[model samples]
Target: MTVERVEFENTFAVLLEDILAELPTFNIPSEGAAWVKECLEYTVPGGKMNRGLSVVDTLRSLRGEHATITPDELHKARVLGWCVEWLQAFFLVADDIMDNSKTRRGMPCWYRREKVGNIAINDAFILESCIYRLLKKYFRQDDYYVDLLDLFHETTYQTELGQLIDLLTAPEDDIDLNRFSIEKHRWIVTYKTAFYSFYLPVALAMIMNGEKREAAFTQARNILIPLGVYFQVQDDYLDCFGDPEVIGKIGTDIEDNKCSWLIVQALDRASAEQRQVLHAHYGRRSAEDVEKIKQIYCDLDLSAVYHAYEEKSYAELCALIDQADANLVPAGVFTKFVAKVYKRNK
Candidate 1:
C-alpha cells in the first residue's frame, strides 16, 4: 500500500515540474518573460497538488490500469491537472491582497514581489487565460470539449461569487464581528474553496470519460461539493488548534479579519461578556490579542462543537457517496481519497 502511495505521490511531483517547465516555453523568451516564468512557477508549485492527482487517480480507479487510456487521453488529463493548479494560483494571488496576507505556502505572495506588487492582479489574469488556452490546445477536439469549457466557466463564476460574498461580509474597512455568520461562512467556502478545489478536478475527469454534461455535473456535485465543504471546514478547524509543524504553516484566520468556522460557531453560542471579548480582540495579530480571543473560544467550548460537526459531516457524506454507484464513477475512489482529508487535523 505504501509503495503504491509513494509511487503515486512521486509521479505527481514530476508532473508538477513538467507543468512548470512547460509554462516558460509558452512565453516569447524575452527579458521580463523570465519573471513571468518565475511568477507562474512559484505561484503554481507550492499548493498541495492533491487536486491534480485526484483527476488522474480517479480516472485510473474508474477505468482500471488494464484499460487503454490513450496517450492523448493521458496528456489531456495532465493538462487538465495544470488547469486546477492555475485556478488555485488565481485565487491565492487575489486572496493574499484581500487578507493582507504577506506570505502564502511559506513564501512571499505574488503581490509582494519587487517588480510585481499590485501587478500580480494582471499576472493572475494571465494564469487564468492559460487554462483556456491549454484546454483549447489539447481537449478541443474531444467530444466533451465544450462541456469541459462550460464547466470551467461556471466553476470560476461560482468561486468568484463566494469570494465576493466573503469580501463584502468581512470588509477590511469595517471590522464588525456581527457580520460573520455560520451560514455565510459555509456559503463562502462552498463556492470559493469547495467548488474549484474539490469538484472541479473530478468533474474534469468525468467530462473526459465522455459522461453526459448533466450527469458529470450531477455526480461531481453529489460528492465533490460536500467534499469541498468538508475540506474547508477542516482547514478552519486546523487554523487555531492545529500543529503548525504538521500543517506546514501557521494559522492566521483570526488576525486577518477573515470569516472562519470557529469564530462563527463561537458567536452563535457566546455569552454577552464573551461576545464583547471576541468583538474587541477577534482580528488582532498581536500575541496578547490572539491569546485573548483563543481564551474566549476555549471558554465557549467551540472545539467540541467543531468536532461534532466534523463527525456528522463525515457520516452524512459517507452515506451520500455510498448511495452513488461505483459503476458510474467509482464511489470507492473518492471515498478512499477524501476519507483521510476529512479526518485529518493538519
Candidate 2:
C-alpha cells in the first residue's frame, strides 16, 4: 500500500508537469502562475484518495495482471484516477469557502490559508479547468475521449445541483425541519456525493477499457449510486457517533444544519417533544445543544437503525453486482467498493 501510495503521489508530479507545460500557452502572470501551482498542490493531493485510486484498482481487476498491461495503458488509468482527485479538489475548495470551513485534510482550507482567501474561488475554477486540460492532453485522440469529457461534465453538473439542493435544504443560520426530509437527504447524497465519488471512478475505468455501451454506464450507476448513498449515510452516522480522532475530524453536522441521514431519520421517528428538541438544538453551535440532539438520537436508537440500514444496503449492492452484465463490468469492481465501506469507521 505504501508503494502504491508513493506511485500515486508521483503521478501528481507528472500531472503538475503537464499543467506547467500547458501554462506557457495561456500567458499567465508570473505571480498568478506560482499561486496556481501552490493552489493545485495544496488542494489536489493528500487525503485517503480512495476515489482516485479506485479507478486504477477497478481497471486492474478488469484488465488482469499488471505485468501483461502495457505502460501506456497503466498511464491512462493513473491519469483518470488523478482526474477524479482533481475534480474533488475543485468541489472541496469552493465548498470550504461556502461552508466557512476552517480546515481540510488536517490543515487550513485553501480559502482559509494565510495568503489566500476569496482567491480560492478562482483557484477552484482553475482546479476544475485542469481536468479537461489533462484529458485533452492525454486522451484527446482516443475513441472514448468525448464520452469521458461528457461523463465528467455531467457528473460535475449533477454534483453542483446536489450542492445547490443541500445548501437550499440546510442553509447557514436557517434551520427548518420541513426541508430535512429523507427524500431530500437521499437526493443530495445521490447527486452530490455518489455520482462523482462512486460512479465517476468506475465509469471512468469502464471507458478507459473501451466499454462504451450506455447500458453498461447505466448498470454501473444503478449499483454504484445506492452504494454511494449508503457510504454518505455511514458518514452521517459517524459524524455524530464516531470518534473525532478516528474519523480525523470533529462532527459538526448537528450544528451545521446539515440534512444528515441521522437527522432525517430522527425527524421521522421523533415525537412532538423530541421534534421540539430538534427545532431548538439542531443547528446551534453550542456544545450543550449538540449533546441534547445527540441524546435524542440515543433515545431514538438511531445506532440500531444505522446498523440495520448498513446490512440491508450491503445486501442490495451485492445482489445488484451479482446480476450486473459480466461483459460490461466485473462484479469484483463493485464488490471491492462494498467490502471497503460496509463496516468501515473511517
Candidate 3:
C-alpha cells in the first residue's frame, strides 16, 4: 500500500477502536454485544473507506481560521465514520441475504454466520439503529442535530428505493438484455449507492461544521449525489473486467444478475448474435457460463466505450462543482471529497 492509503487505514482504525471502547458501556446482553463487535470488526475493515475519510478530510478543509480537530473534533469525525460504516453494514447484510452471498470482507456475511442465519434480518435492523445511537451520543446537542438525523434517513430511503428498483428491474432469474439501459443504470446507482456512499459523509461533515444546513444539503444533492453515482458506475464497469487481485473480489454481476455498467453498455451496443450470447450466458453462476458472457463483453470491446463515458461523467461532475463554487459551500471540502474517491481500485 502507498503511504497515503496507510494514513487512511490508520485513521479509520483509530475511529473504530474508539467506537468499540464506548460501545460496551451500553446496556446489552453478551450475545448482542458480541454480535455488534464482530459485525463492526469484520464488515468495516474490508472497504476502501473513501467515504469515511471524506468526512475527516472535508472537516479539515472546512476549518476556516487555522482550525484544529481536537479530541472532540476527532470524536465527531469518528462518529461520522461510524455512521458511514453503519449505513454500509445495513445494506451489505441485507444485500448478502438478497444475493445469497457467501463471503464479505474475507469473512462470512453477517446473515450467514453460524449463529445468525435468517435472524440476520433483525441483525441488519440493529446495525442500522446503531447509527442513530452514535449520532445521538455525539452530536445531539448541535443545532444541526435534527438535520443530521433527517439527512441519514432521507438518504437511506433513497438508497433502499434504488435497491428495490434494481432488484425488480433486474431479477436474478431473468437476464433479459432489454432490461439493462443507461437510464436504468443511472437510476439504480444514483439512488442505491451514491447518496449514502458519496454524499452522506460530506453532508454530515458540513452539517456539523455549522454550514447553512439547508443550503449545504442542496449543494451536496446537486454535486456529490451525481459524483456518488459516477463512483458506483465505475465499480460496476470494473467488476467484470478488472483484475481480481487489484479489485480484490472476482466479478460476479452477471451471475448475480446485477444491473451493472458493462451489461447495460453491452445491451446498448450488442448485435443480434451478441444479444443471444448475453441471454444464454448472463447471470449464470456457473464458471463456464460466466466466462462465456465475459468473452462476449470482450468481443464487443466495452471498456474503451466505458472509459470514454467515465471520463465524460467525471468531466461533467467537475464542471458542476466548479460552477457551484466552494465559496458558496466550502470548495476545498468537495475537492478533497472528489480526491478521496476519484477512482479507487479496490
Best model number under TM-score: 2
lDDT of 2 by residue, 236-337 (tens): 999889877777666778888899999999999999999999998888888999999999999999999999999999888888888888887778888889
For residues 50-169, what per-residue lDDT tens digits would candidate 1 score against the true structure? 777677776777687588887667666777777888888888888787787776777777788887888888888877876787777677777888988998999999999999998888
Q: Return whichever of 1 and 3 wins on lDDT.
A: 1
Task: Give Cα distance to truth, residue 324, candidate 2, Å.
Answer: 2.5
| Runs off by more than 4 Å, candidate 1 | 1-29
Better of 1 and 2 by lDDT: 2
Residue 327 lDDT (model 3): 62
Instruction: State candidate 3's TM-score.
Output: 0.89
lDDT of 2: 0.89
Model 2: lowest-lDDT 10 consecutive positions: 61-70
Whose lDDT is greatest here? 2
Per-prediction CA RMSD (Å): 3.0, 1.6, 2.9
